[model samples]
Target: MKTILVIGTYDTKDDELHYICQRIADMGGQVLSMDVSVLGDPSAPTDLSKHQVAEAGGASIRQAIDAGDENAAMQIMARGAAALTAQLYADGKIDGMLALGGTMGTDLALDCAQALPLGVPKYVVSTVSFSPLIPADRLAPDIQMILWAGGLYGLNSVCKSSLSQAAGAVLGAAMAVEAPVSTRPVIGMTSLGSSCLKYMKHLRDPLQERGFEVAVFHATGMGGMAFESLAQQGYFAAVMDFALPELGNLMVGSVVHSGPERLTRAGAAGTPQIVAPGCADLVDYAGWQDIPAAYTDRPFHAHNRLIKSAALSGDERRALVRDIVARLERANAPVHVLMPKGGVEEWDREGGEAHDPQALAAMADEMEKTVKAPLGLTMLDAHINDAAFADAALAVLDGWIADGTVKLG
Candidate 1:
C-alpha cells in the first residue's frame, strides 16, 4: 500500500535500479522510477525521464552535456531532482524515497532527500555513506543512510543485500512511521544534561500542567541543530532557549558545533523566545582530540569520553556576552534574557571543577552593559541549576501567557 520513489542514474545503473524496483513490487509496494542520467538513455523509460529532470531544473539535457563538466552538470540535475521530488511529495504520490549512488549519485541523492519535509522517509544507499565529504548541513535531520558495500560494479550478493535492505527500510518506515503530534501548544526548550543544568526536570511538569507540551533539547551540537531546524519550520509556539554552549562553541572555533545559523532562526521566524546565558561561558570539544592551544591552561571538564567542556577567560566571556546581546537585539519577536549570576552551568558554581567566580562576574557585567531597553533583561541571584531559576522562567512564561504574547491551548 506504500509508495517509494526510487531515484538513480538509470542510464548507468540499469540492472541495479531495476532489481531494486522488482524487490519493492514483490513486497507489494508501488515504485516510481526517476532517471537522472545526463548522457545515456534508460533501457526503456522511467516514470520521470532524464529530459524531464533536466527541464525541471530549467534547462535541457543538451545543456548539461554541453557544459562538459560532470560537477556542473550534476548540479543542474540536483536542482531539478530536488524540485521534482518536493513536487512528488506535495502531490501525495510518494510516502518514502530510496536513492542509490557513488559520490556523484550520493551528492544528488542528498539534495533530493532534503527536498522532502522532516518526517517523510528518506533512505540513501551510497559508497560514501558516512564520509566527511558530505557536510552535516546538507543532510536532512532524520535521513537514513546505508553504505553501498561492494556495489561499485555489476550486481553481487553484497550489493543486493544492501539494496534489498534499503527497499524494506524505506517501505517499513513509510508504513510504520508516526508523525510528530501534540494535543497542546508546544514549548521548545533547550538546556544541558541534568548534571550540568537541571531546569528541564523542574520546568517540564509545571509547563505540562499549564496545558503546554515542553520539548527539552540538550544543547550539544546535533541537538541544537535539531532544535533550530524545527524552530525555523515554525514548530514552536514559544521557546525557552536556555542551553547555549553551541553558540559559544561556534564562536570559539570549535568543530563540535551546530550550523552557523543557530540562535537567530527561531527569532527570525517570529517565535517568541526566552533567552538565557546558560552555559555560555563554556566551549565544548571532542574529548579524544588534543585540547586547542588557546584553552590549554583554562579550566576543563571531561564530561565523558565523547565530549568535554572548556571555560573561557574573563575578557573572552565579556566579548562573547556582547556578541550574544547583539544577536538578541535583531529578534523580530519579543526576547528576554534571564541571567543566573551565581553560575551558568553546574560545574561553574561552588565546589565544582569549573567554579570561577571572577569569570562569572565578568560575564554578568558585560551582559548588563550590553543589553539595552526594549529587550528584557533579568539577572537572577541563582545558579541555572537552582529551583529559583526555574521559578523565574515560569513566571516569565506566565506573564507572556496572561498578555497573550503566547497563546493558550
Candidate 2:
C-alpha cells in the first residue's frame, strides 16, 4: 500500500488531521503523521513527534518553546520539518505527502513540500493558497493546493467535503504515477500567449525529432520563476529563452516581476542557452490595475479582462536590452543572442498596436554595442514569429548539440 505523509501542527489541528488520516486509510492507504507543533503537546498521536522534528532542524524542542518569540519558534520548526520530510522521501518511506494549515501552517508546509523533488505528489490544504502572502518564487513547480474554506478550528460538512476531495486527489495521483524507466534530455523553452507562441510551436516538434523532450513554460510570472528554480536545480539540458517581458516588468516595478534572478540561472549552471527579445517591447499589469503615473502616456493594449500590456518607450527598451546583455555576459556556458529586425512580437509587427521602429532600433543598437565576444550575437531580417527566425534559432541549437557544447541524453 502507498503511504501518504500527513503533516500539520497536531497540537492545534488534531481533529481535522485525524479526519483526513481516517479518510486516507479507508481509501486503502497508510498514513505517516508528522507533528510540527512548537508550543503545546499534540492532541493526536504522531508517527514523528515535534521533538524529533525540532532536533532535525538543529534545535531542541525545549529551546523552541523557551525562545519566547512565536515567529522564531515557528521558523525553527519549519527548518526541522523540511529536513525530516526530505530524509523520509529519500529513504523511500513516502509515496506522497499532504498537509493542512492556516497561515503559519501553510508556511511550514511550503517548506516541507519544496524539500521533495519535482514530479512527487505534493498537496496543501491551506487558507491562503494563492494569496499574496505566499511568495510565488518559493512555490514548487508541481505542487497543488486547495483553499481551506469554512474549516477553521473543527471539522464540519463543508470542511469534510473539501478534505475528502483532497484525500482522493492525492491518493489517485500517487497511485497513477509510473516511475520513468528511461530519461530523455529535457529542453526548457519559454513563451507568452498568442503574442510569442509561434516560436514555441515551431521549435517543440523539431527538438523532439532531434531526440529531446521540450518543456514549455508560459512566460507568466510564476511560470518563469518555476523555470529558473528548475534550472538552478540542473533540470534542463538546454534552454531557449524566447520571452523576457518579466524582466522588463521587474525593471519598471510591476507586480508581474518573476523574481530578481530571472535570466541568470542557465548561464550560472553552464547550460547552453539561445536568448531572444520575444516580448521585451512590453510590460504587463493586471487588467484592473491603473497605469502607473510614470507610464500613463505610453501605448497600452488590453488582452482581456485580466491582463493588460504596455509598450516600452525607447529609453525603457534600451534599459531592457542592457539588462539582458549583463545577464548573458556572466554565462559560463555557450550563449547566443538572436535579434529579429522586423519585430519581436505580434503586437509589435508592422501595422500593429505596439509597432515602433525607433524603439526597436534603439534596443538593437544597445545590444550590438554591449554584447561582447565569448557570447555570439546574430541579427535576422525576419520577424520573431516568421519561419526564417525559427529556422535560425533551431540551427544554432542544433550546431551546439553536434559540437558537444550542449550534451544530449
Candidate 3:
C-alpha cells in the first residue's frame, strides 16, 4: 500500500486534514498525519503530535510557543515538519505527501516537501494557492495543485468531494508509476535552429560515448529558459550552453530573449557549467522584410529564405561582453567562457557574410577584462562546431566536476 503523509496545523484545520487522511485510508493507502500546531490541542488523533514535532526540532513545545513570534514559530514548525517527514521516509512510511493550509500551514508543509528529492508527488491544497506568493515561499520547483478555495473556513460537500478525488489522484499516481530509468548525468544544451542541429550532433555522439547524456534546447526564448530552469531544479549535472543569440535578440528588442534569470541558475545551483559565445555573432530576425531598415546598412547573412542575421556592432559587442561577464560572476558553479576565434556561428567563419575580425576581437578583449579569478576564460582558434572545440569544452566541465572546483552554493 502507498503511504500518504498529510501535514497541517491540526490545532486549527484538523477536521479538513483528517477528512482528507480518511479518504486516503479509504483508498487503501496508509496515512501518517502530522500536526504542526503552535497553540491549542490537535483536533484529531495524529501519528505525530505537535509536542513530538517540537522535540524533534530540538526545542520543547511550550518553549517554542512561548517565543510568540510568527516567523520563529514558522521556523520551529518547518524544522519539525522536515524532521518528521525524514523520519517517516527513513522508516519506509512515506510514499507520497500532501498538505492542507492557508499561509502558515503552507509554509510549514512546503519546507518538508522541498526537502524531499525532485519527482516525488507533493500536493498542496491551500487558500493562498491562488494568492500572489512572496519570494520567501515560492513553490516554483514543486508541483502544486491549486484549488481555488476562496476564503472558506470549513469544507462544504463540494470541497470534500474535490479534495477526496485529489487524494485518490495523488495516491494512484504514487503507487501505479514505474520508476524512472537511472540514466547517466545528462547536460541540457541550448542552441538555435540555424546552428543547433550540427552543433548538437557534433557534441552528443562524443559525450554519449563517454557515458553522458546531452539534451539540446532550441534557443527559442522558452527553450533557453527551460534549459536553465532545469539546471536550477538540479535536473542536469552540467550545462553545455552554446547558443546565446537570445542575448542579441534582447539587446536589439527582438521577440526571442529568455528572461533575466538565464545564466544565474548554474551559479545559484552550483551545477558545473561551460558557456560559449556560439551564435552570438548576430541577432535573429524574422522574414527578410522584417529586418529593420536601420539594420539594412549593416553586414547581414541570409541563413534561409525566412531568417536574416545582423552582425553585432563594436558597441554592441562591448555591452554583450559585460552582460556575459556579469552572468559568469553570478554563477556559483565553476564557469568557463569559450570564445571561438575562428567564428561564433556557422556563418561567422572566413568568407562568411557576417564575419567581422574587429568585432570578434573587441568581444574577446572585453571578456578577458571582465572575467577574473576562479572563473576561467578560454580562447579557441577553431569555430564552435569544430571537434577540437567541443572536446575542449567537455574537458573543462569534466575537470571541474572531478576536482570539485565549483563550490555548491
Name the candidate that leads on TM-score.
2
Worst 10 residues of 1 by lDDT: 132-141
**Model 3 stretches with alpha carbons more than 4 Å out:** 130-142, 148-151, 178-183, 188-206, 215-237, 241-271, 277-334, 339-365, 372-374, 379-409
Note the residue pairs that clash in candidate 3: 267-331, 267-332
lDDT of each: 0.89, 0.87, 0.75
TM-score per candidate, chains pooled? 0.94, 0.95, 0.65
Per-residue alpha-carbon lDDT of candidate 3 for residues 1-409, written as tens digits (9 for 90 to 100): 8888888888777677778888988889988888888787775578888888888888877878787797787788789888888778778778778888877877776678765654567787776764435232234343556572532577678678657877987798788756434468777788877443256766788777767777787775657765765677777778888889887778777765666676678778987778888877688775545778877877797777756778888779889878877887877767888877777777667777887888888887777778787778888888777877888887886686568653222
Tens digits of lDDT, candidate 1, 191-237:
88888888898899999999998888877776787788888888898
> What is the clash count of model 2?
0
- Flag regions of model 2 displaced more than 4 Å: 179-182
Model 1 lDDT at residue 139: 71
RMSD of each: 1.9, 1.7, 7.5
Who is ahead in lDDT, 2 or 3? 2
* Deviation in Å, model 2, residue 220 alpha carbon: 0.2
